[model samples]
Target: MTPQMRHRLVHAGWLAAALAALGGVFVLYVHPDFLVTLVDQVWSCF
Candidate 1:
């Protein structure tokens, strides 16, 4: 692939990752119980 195409693909990948991160944050904010459960599970693993 061309350099320009590769650059565009890299940029798109970063954007997609950022949006997914933001979505996950929103979900956690809306349902804090999920976060609590996750923490509990992790603590149990120790």
Candidate 2:
């Protein structure tokens, strides 16, 4: 592959990863149990 094509592929990979992370966060936010479990875990660290 060309250097320019490789650069574009890398950029697309990062964008995809970011989108997936955001989607996962959104799904977790929509689930109350996940929030409660997350809070409990954090609180335990204190």
Candidate 3:
């Protein structure tokens, strides 16, 4: 892969991880129902 592609892939992976972490926090502190909703939202993008 090209350098630009590699960088973009890494960035995307980090973004996905960050979103998942946020979802975990919401599920822990706000509402458990958000966990499934957020995960499904994330997966639906791809």
> How are the candidates ranked when ordered by TM-score, highest leading?
1, 2, 3
Extract clashing residue pairs from model 3: none
Largest lDDT belongs to which candidate? 1
lDDT (tens digit, per residue) of candidate 3 on 1-46? 9999999999999999999999878767777567778789999999
RMSD of each candidate relative to the true structure:
1.0, 1.5, 9.0
**lDDT values, one for every candidate:** 0.99, 0.96, 0.89
Clashing pairs in 2: none
Model 1 residue runs over 4 Å out of place are none
TM-score of each: 0.87, 0.73, 0.63
Q: Residues 1-46, candidate 1: write the lDDT tens digits.
A: 9999999999999999999999999999999999999999999999
* Minimal lDDT window, size 10, model 3: 26-35
Best by TM-score: 1
lDDT of 2 by residue, 1-46 (tens): 9999999999999999999999999998899798899899999999
Output the lDDT of residue 1, model 1.
100
